[model samples]
Target: MAQPQPIPGTTIFDGIQAAKGYALNKMCFSFNDAGNRAAFKADEEGYMARFQLTAPQAEAIRKRDVLGLLAAGGNVYYLAKFAGILGLDVQDLGAAQTGMSKQDFKAMLVRANEQVIH
Candidate 1:
């Protein structure tokens, strides 16, 4: 059987990625709790240490680099919690991922919505 072609600019969150992202995703999941979010805000380094995040994962979290987080195996769903802690929404993440200005990304979404509605 022929191997499936990988999608360009897309990372597949397979079993390996799930294992790799376990720590990071777990930490993000903790953000569901207000106290946990406050604790992370209070001591970013200490909180990451508690989660045992890898060097790259730690750096990505510190930098708030969405693409880097994804490359490090972060799932968008879990990352949403992290983004919430940073006062960002899914549209912000979409803009960052697409390399588009937030305004442009929002405009694109509006256009896409219009196409479907009309």
Candidate 2:
């Protein structure tokens, strides 16, 4: 019998997929309704307050602080998407157990972004 292989872009951690789903849901919800989009756009401060992130955490995200997100238990793929939404670049953290380098993960992210746009 042959061992099963992971899907081309799947990560080992299930939590990472959950986090990405959650963020995508939030983004879609925010865009699907006029009121939601207005609320998000009208009060940037209050919009962030909804996440309940600490000041430093929010600041770190704003600064594209990959180290901080890692310290906060953020999944790198999800964090990259968050950084994308924030107009920031995702920095390479290192390699995964599957021998996928951080650069490979970033390229996967770019592909994911293209999928989202399409």
- TM for candidate 2 is 0.39
| Deviation (Å) of 47 in candidate 2 | 2.2
The residue-by-residue lDDT of candidate 1 on 14-70, one tens digit each, is 778899999999999999999999999999999999999999999999999999998
lDDT of 2: 0.54
Maximum-TM-score candidate = 1
TM-score of each: 0.90, 0.39
Off by over 4 Å in 1: 1-4
Candidate 1 has its poorest 10 consecutive residues by lDDT at: 1-10
lDDT of 1: 0.93
Q: CA lDDT, every prediction?
A: 0.93, 0.54
Q: Which candidate number has the best lDDT? A: 1
